[model samples]
Target: MIRPSGRTDSRLLWPIAIHPFTGTVEVVFQHLKRSPPLDDEPLRRELMTKLNEIEGVDLAEAKLDLRPSFPVEVFAEHSEEICAVPEWFAHTVALAEARRMPDGDPGTY
Candidate 1:
């Protein structure tokens, strides 16, 4: 949910997801429509190296996934391709809010 801002603030963004329990890190390549320099392996490796320097991050276990700019509603009726979740939009938003909510309950906090 982080956005980069700068003079060169291209619409491109890299969404990094870190799982607290399993320690799985995912980098979703959502802005493929825009030219992102990380598509280059060298740059990706360099960034991964820097990220791995942190105590808990392991670049080796990192997973790469794509989050297309297309609306989730469009994929709701899709039957051929298997979605990551049974319900994509609700599940995705719930997952995000769950991560944001410390006690797992947004209302309580």
Candidate 2:
């Protein structure tokens, strides 16, 4: 949400999200492009291996989209650049507002 000061909050819920599928151990689950990223395959493997050793559960049917995302919040406070990430929602919202339509025009939605 954009605040009264015109800055938008850009925090993600978590670093990563896990999904499970059918079968034994399918590695990982597919995530949307906008999801927060953990991006740790080796760590996941280690944890999964440990989990298997500890619980003896099969996890072969998983499909992982291990990815890393660099949020603008990391640099929001450090640099003069307000929105470092051009594609970020905050940045895009700002751009849209900048090009705002005139009142009673019913511009393309």
lDDT to native, each model: 0.39, 0.33
| Cα deviation of 6, candidate 1, in Å | 20
lDDT of 2 by residue, 16-109 (tens): 3333332222223233222212223553444344333322333341433443222333333433332232234334333434454345232222
Candidate 2 Cα RMSD after full superposition onto the native fold (Å): 15.5
Q: Taking the tens digit of each residue's C-alpha lDDT, what string does model 1 give over 2-97?
A: 224211122224434445565344545433223334444454455445444444444453332243122233233443332332233234344544
**CA lDDT, candidate 2, residue 52:** 37
Q: What is the lDDT of candidate 1?
A: 0.39
- Give the runs in model 2 whose Cα sits over 4 Å from its true position: 1-29, 32-37, 61-109
Decoy 1 TM-score against native:
0.35
Model 2 TM-score, all chains together: 0.25
Count of steric clashes across candidates, in order: 0, 13
Name the candidate that leads on lDDT: 1
Q: Which candidate tops TM-score?
A: 1
In angstroms, give how far residue 24 of model 2 lies from its true place: 12
